[model samples]
Target: MKFLVLCLIALIHQSASQSPQASCQFENSIDYTCVLTLTNPNGLNNITEIEVNHMPNRTNDDVVIVRTSIFSTSRNIPSIICDTFRNLRSIDMFRTGLTKIDEDSVSNCKLLELMTVRFNQIADIHPNAFAENAELRTVQLDANNLTSVPENLFENNKKLVEINLSQNGLAVLPKKLLSGLSELRGLFLTHNQISEIYEDTFADATNITSLGLGNNSLTYLPDKIFSSLYNLLDVYLQNNQLMKFNPYWFQNAKSLRALYLSNNGITYFPEDSFVNFYKLRELMLDRNPIQKLPGKIFASLGELTWLDLENCQLVYLDPSLFLSTYNLWMLKLANNDIYELPGGVFGSLKYLATLDMTNNQLQAISSTSFYFHPDLRTVRFGQNQINAVDEKFLDVVNVTQLNMEQNVCADGFWNDDSETKELFRTELRVCFENYIEPPQYCPIGNEYERICELEAQTASLTLENAGIRRDLEGLAARIEQLERLISSSP
Candidate 1:
């Protein structure tokens, strides 16, 4: 019995000396080893989340995986970090040249919880790539070249919180994809070719916070899309070919905060497009082909602050549109064939600060076009055939760049003589030099002031022209830096 005890001690010593290859996800020096006895590698891509930068490095004496994939690399790229711990928690193989990984290849890493395989040219993934490791939290497969997903992909992953498979080639998601993932938080499928969504998409996620399906080809949504998701906050549906919208689309998502539906073929938006999203803050409808909007299109969104309507086919618009939201800030109507701004266009938006009417055809600007109580800041008239601009087009706020360079401005709008232009020049010079982030001011204060100041200052300014330094490609780096500094300062 004494001889047997000595032999067992020798065996244990030998096993502890042979250190396995490990990865450190944090900035610590602690070492870790594969805790194989406690780990079950039967789950699909069994990953132990080691949030790098987001989560401080774990410094336990036992080996721990450091989470640092996103801060270090993009899709499918591999990197190495020194480790002192005996256990690894997260493995990021995202965008690296890895084609496959299964339980056999990763049998040595017994404590992995998360794996990032995004944007790789991977065509196949084994079903049992990961097993019953419970400490995993996230698996991101965004922008990958995946053709399909295997069954029981996340079978025994109890701690997995988020699964990002967006921007893939998923035609229709499998029903049992997330059956075992009960605590998932986010489901991202933006920029995919998913033409339809069945009720099974939300089967496993009870605490989903955000669902991104922005650039899909879906014509309509089924009723059960948000059946299991009670905590959803945002839904992105931009760049889809949606022709008609129904109020029942988002009837269940009552806690939504933002909705994006820009750049689609939506000709008309139903008044109930925002029926259930009571907490919505921002609504984007830019670059759509919508020729008209429902009289109360934004009636349901009481907290709507910004409404983007650029590049839409809005030949005609109602003047008294904004009646519900009292906190409206910005309204964009650029790149449309708007012939005139109705006198009561901004009658409802009493708190509007910025109005971007850029690249639109307008014959004239009247003082009554704007109803802001000195709250308006910047207004763009660039890329437009604006025939005239008077003092009514702007205000004296912070900074303003009324881009009417090509527009036909009547001559002698500033002063009959050049001496009065000096006073205007001082005001614009002081305003721009002292103001913080590019501000908006009265068109009279912005345009005439800039023209006079630059005209006077241009005569005294002298420096090496950038056109003269194009002789050598070798010295472009240093020359570029010099050019930037000179251009940025006054």
Candidate 2:
């Protein structure tokens, strides 16, 4: 009888020792609530049976926030874990190898307000997965393999302020997916396969401020898709296949500030494309195939401060292209076919600070290329065929940083410093000794001709004044000689 009892006790001890274990530690106190962090370092497939050690002064009920990390093979969040933390307010699980979110996985945590299950292999989430978490305010499920989500997925979470579904395989958003998320402030759907958005998709998201839809396969957008988002501010649509830009997309989003449309197939823009975006501050149109821009295209964007047009295949720029964007602070025109900068092309950008014209075919940096902008600080002209730099180039624009590398000028001429003026003079006498001004493609308008005439008249007047001074000096010498002769005779 004693030997049988001993065998039974040994069997029980061995079975308990082999069970997977998850350790819990007390984190810093947040809002006077004890926060507990549970970690499974043994690649445990089951964490529900693990015992949790509460803080010295707190019990399981006293914990409000629970974070789980480093779980290598947990397929789903066990309901028993959330059931134990009935008063939980937040749960964060990252890179846990979770493949799916089962319905009511966290339904026991009634007070849950924030949930983050990012960087996991989660491909599907049950439509009612978060149905019971009515108070949920933020949900971040980015970097997952989710291709689609149900339309009513977030219907119960009315107070949701932000949702980040970026870096996923989502191809399309259901028409009513965000139907009642009136309190939504930010929605990030970048790096997905989204191709189309219904016109009423954002009709109820009137209060949304920032929308990110970059790096997608969207080739077209409905004209009135964003007609209801009046408070929209920043929009990111870069790296998409958008063939054209529609002004009606932002017809009602007057509060827009930043607009990004780089790496698209857009070839041109109508003159009134940005007429409704009066308050827009930043505009990025780089990496397009646009060969030319219409004059007065930016006439209404007086408040625009940043403009990017890099790699647009622009062979020429209209002289009055930027006639109204006076507040522009940065302009990027790099990696194009521009052979010359039309005179007064940047005359209206009085606040222009940084100008990038690198990797172009510009043959010369003329004196009138850059108009006087007091804040001009950086100018890049590298990788061009520039053999002639006007002696007055630096005098017109006082750029503190100038990049002229890989040009025809001597190495010493690329130096940009207080002595740059003297270096430029020396380079002109040596490298550009036989330089001839390139023929202007744009006609020298009446204003330019009138200025040239004025300059010629001034030069002729200066020569006449010098000759008069020499004659006056000779007459004074003769008069003094005569006076000395008269005095000697007396």
Candidate 3:
């Protein structure tokens, strides 16, 4: 019988290539979109509608956006398996070790608009999960393990614009939980464990424009909680334990722009907090314990541009503290106890560019220290007690990365060569040729006491020219011993 019909057609092509939908790895797209990747689904739980009717040349109504990545599946997500993709609009369930998400999972993907259960271990979600996916606009349950979420979840997704519960473990947020997200604009509850936030919790999410409560464990914040966020723009309350900084919490968020209060416990900032933030532009109060700042506190933040007061234990600053931020360009007063920088304190920052006074208690760098930066570029006076450096301090700023490491000269006297600015101005005239007088709270002026009296009269004419070159080498060795005793007495 022709060897038993070729051994039954090689045992039916090795049992149809060991099927379990052949370990799913489909790709169909040509508008009928379907990207099913089930890697490591070794204990394959279920995806059978006979595996979407054996998806080979696409069939279940010719699929419609099903993007799935079920890696290392633990369980629960097979609930009717998206009711066989009822012409699903979009469903991306990545890293599926999914834990809870009831309500028939995708409620039969009722023309779902976009749902990405990202990095799952999903804590619990069935508050009518998506209540029949009312054209859900976008919902990426961010890096899940969500602590709480279901104040009517998305209350029937009123075309929800974006909702990413950032790195979840959320502490508390259900204040009507965006009750009717009027096309919500971008709400990312960053690294949650949120201490408190229910002042109407975004009131109705008034057209939110990027709000990411950073790190979170917030100290206090219900002063009108953002007043009603009138078209707010970028507000990430960094780290958080905010001690004080409530200018009525943005008295109506005047279209705010970038305010990340870095690792807070903020020591101060009441002076009109930011007087309506005049279109604020990137202000990050770095690691706060702020010693002093209220010099009209950024006056009204005249369109500020990136200011980060690093490690604030600042000793003093008010030289008009950035006088209206003259369109600042990256300023970071590093590790402060700032000894003194007062003279025109950065003189209205003429478009300053990257100034980080590293490890302060600065002794001297005066020549009006960066004399009004002409587009200054990278100046980090490392570990200060800088033994005076103004031989016109690199002739008035044009710094191209000058990090005077562990100051007081002698360590190759600092370098980053703008051709070492005339070799650090001839090594600051021989490392301070006995240069002293700097104290009177050193903001250094009296023209630095006339350049330390012309570097002490040029170190006393360089010790009278090394004592006339050692008396002309001892009279040229007594004229070579009187010409060898006059040629040995003739």
Top candidate on lDDT is 2
What are the models' TM-scores? Answer: 0.66, 0.83, 0.33
Question: How well is each residue in 166-241 modelled by candidate 3, as lDDT tens digits?
Answer: 9989898888888878778899989989898878778777888898989989899878887877888898999978
Candidate 1 per-residue C-alpha lDDT over 386-464 given as tens digits, one digit per residue, 9 for 90 to 100: 5544332233221133344344432111221231235334423423333232122222322123322332333233333
Q: Backbone collision count in every prediction?
A: 41, 0, 1
Candidate lDDT scores, in order, read: 0.57, 0.77, 0.71
Clashing pairs in 3: 417-420
> Where does candidate 1 stray beyond 4 Å?
1-61, 66-86, 105-111, 388-399, 410-490
Q: Tell me the lDDT of candidate 1.
A: 0.57
Give the candidate order by descending lDDT. Answer: 2, 3, 1
Tens digit of per-residue lDDT, candidate 2, span 111-209:
899898999888889999999998999999999999999899998898999999999999999889897899999999999999998989998888999
**Count of clashes in candidate 2:** 0
User: In candidate 2, where is summed lDDT lowest over 10 consecutive residues?
Assistant: 460-469
How well does model 3 score by local distance difference test? 0.71
Residue 356, candidate 3: alpha-carbon lDDT: 88
Residue 187 in candidate 3, Cα distance off native in Å: 14
Worst 10 residues of 3 by lDDT: 460-469
